[model samples]
Target: MPERVVPGRPDGLITLGAADALWVDLTAGSAVPTAFGAFTRSPARARAGYVLLGGRAVTTVRASGGRWSVSVGEVRRAAAELNAVGTDPQDLVRIGPFHGAPWQEADEETVLCWRRRIAGGLWEPGRPQRAARRDLDRPYHLAGIDWRQMLVERTRDGTQRTWWLPRAVVRLLDAAEHAEAQWLQASQTHQAGAAVTGPPSHPRRAARDAGGRQATDPEGPAASLRPYNGELKGQLYSVLSRKPGTSRGVAGWACAVCRTAPAAVLDHCHEHGYVRAPVCQSCNTLERPDHLYSNDIRVANRYTRLFHTDTDDWLRHWHRCPGCRARTTLPLPHLAAWTAHTACRSLRPTHRAPRGRTPCGVLRVSWTGSQNTPRSCLLTVTVDCCPSGEHRLLAQVPYREAVERFRVWLAETAPAVAAAAGPDRLDGLPTEPRPVVADTSGEGLALF
Candidate 1:
């Protein structure tokens, strides 16, 4: 039988230029479990036999804000590397110079294509070099390499999307693929003998609880004991656990907003804890100011409608005022403006009307009750009016009792409101301004 392609070593950071050894990715190109070779190259002479893929030398310019930008050549070098791994490598000379200014600006086609290469919205520095280890029983190898290398394709719009992989990784990945095929064939033909891959006994089944149930320790050694699946659920789980707005999630296959660029990162509502959709960096960055600072409810709603899979809850609640029958926006939870909408106090003054309008209305809800007094929750509704003391008291009652009464009031008042209050009609509302993001990089900007 051919030599079994065993795991190289316990994976950790190893200096590439130092000692020579085999660095094998047990899962091939699937997940981030590439292991540093456990054993050094057998002989010093063997070092000469292996080829090393050299990285492009990157030159960085740090702006006054400490943001980094790379030369135009670096972008071309990345494009070249990505094309080299594709089925049809396009000519680097044929690809035109980037159109945007400062070399960091994101366009629809380029940003979308750029997001596919990056795991999150932002290009993580040194991510292309590091492979976090994932435990697997069988030493399975698949075709192609990991996210370290990417393939490039030309879009119909004449823009390019590409990801780069090193030649060294490509060679090792190809070798590991061959090794796996050989091992599988050997195990199939010789069933009577020991299998070529996988441990003698599964590590996850090794430990048991007092009740005779299988014990699991995801934070311990058992974290790495599970079987490998192609879906990358392990990495996704890690990403979901992080704080909101962290550009640590996987890249989207397509941007949900523009639908033109590939989504570069997972966009989320920091205030509402709503995990939105994978979107391009431009779309993701554009969402923040609109949701937080913009006074025009329609503009903010437009973004929410596009990026969020479901906008019914947002629309039905804060999007339209029940009293004034006008569309309005709400502030984040921590902002002082949010107090007007929550019944934490006996009574609070309503928010000043949005710029250039009268006090539209205020709809406040309060669920304040201890475990011993669950029924103490209350809902208070009020609308600010032009004359002081002329304010209308819509409702004040137990939270359970208030819902039915409020619905009755809303039903009666719905017909009299003007037809101009439709949420979808955004012809004359204020437009969101284009925001300039800080350009930061390590080696260089990956999305350029």
Candidate 2:
């Protein structure tokens, strides 16, 4: 064994350093789990090995205002040591930067090629040095190895998308925060549900205070164990225990995406245990802003067709998250997937050209229970509104289109109202909505 000495800190947990072992304690918000009740030391070590060797850490969790604050600073020390490249063969792995590799420069290729290549995503054909950024998209979870991942990509269709996430995401996420985000993401997956890698026998929530309970504790009650956070535990059961997103006992209010309230987020820590955060259901449960395949590693190209084999394909994904390196399955179908549904749901993520006056009178109204139907109307009426909280709404009212349609329909169906209407009354209303592609294929079916 490599010098089994604990660099002792106040936290009693010793870190075995390169030179020698020293007794040192950690600071208040140290990333190292002191005594996490949810996991065995063996798995944790394997995980830790993978993380430490990465040369980075999630310094900021999503809830921590997306800031990377918690690091042992060992990363800097590690960098300095590894910066020399070929220092000590025993402690250092040669991360041969593939300054020259035959990577795809085409806009059409995706990371899936690495899945079928002779070198695999990790290795080179002839004593490959370190892998290139365009080299990996699969979940290469082993520690102490050189791995490459892409953070963005340009699709062949002349559209650009991000497969890898931002670096700010790192150093910002600790294990628990990352785990919760992943857990919340796994729940909202579409046709090919997301997968959880290296599941603990009975994963439990992280304990916040001394009063928090632990099932794994020798003296604690294990039979009736529940998640550490009470509200989230209740909500997780409500949304996940039964069919996903269905109306269950908890009103699916806990279903972060569907419910209007910021829902509880779930994850695990190295030493602390599972962590659940109170976040917008949409951000937490619906479209995973965190789950992405970057420009270099085109994950979408890989899984578009991986499940035709006799083997249980869905159960065998190996793509690791660039954020926490948490192993995850295919991108979950968002509760509001399908281009039309997605666009209708979040105007923030959607981009549409301004509507122009069209021959067909179209009224795209997003209505809520509180609002009554217009006293009189005409033309084409389309509404893609879903019900939510009583009032506290964050929706975008179709400012221009709705107004134009109202007036046009009034002119045809209720000309009296059109004549009575004043320009001041519809100041924000445009003269017309731009003509859209006759193709409704990209749009959502009209919803109530």
For all predicted structures, in order, the TM-scores are: 0.22, 0.19
Model 2, global lDDT: 0.24
Could you give candidate 1's per-residue lDDT for residues 155-254 as a string of tens digits? 3224333233332333333222222222333334444332455433221122243332222211211121222122321123235647564432233234
State model 1's lDDT. 0.29
What is the RMSD of candidate 2? 23.6
Q: Which number leads on TM-score?
A: 1
Flag regions of model 1 displaced more than 4 Å: 1-276, 279-374, 384-389, 397-448
Deviation (Å) of 203 in candidate 1: 48
Worst 10 residues of 2 by lDDT: 316-325
lDDT of 2 by residue, 119-195 (tens): 34444457533334552443332112212322233232343221222222121111122233333233244213213
Off by over 4 Å in 2: 1-139, 142-159, 164-277, 280-448
What is candidate 2's CA lDDT for residue 145? Answer: 21
Model-by-model lDDT, in order?
0.29, 0.24
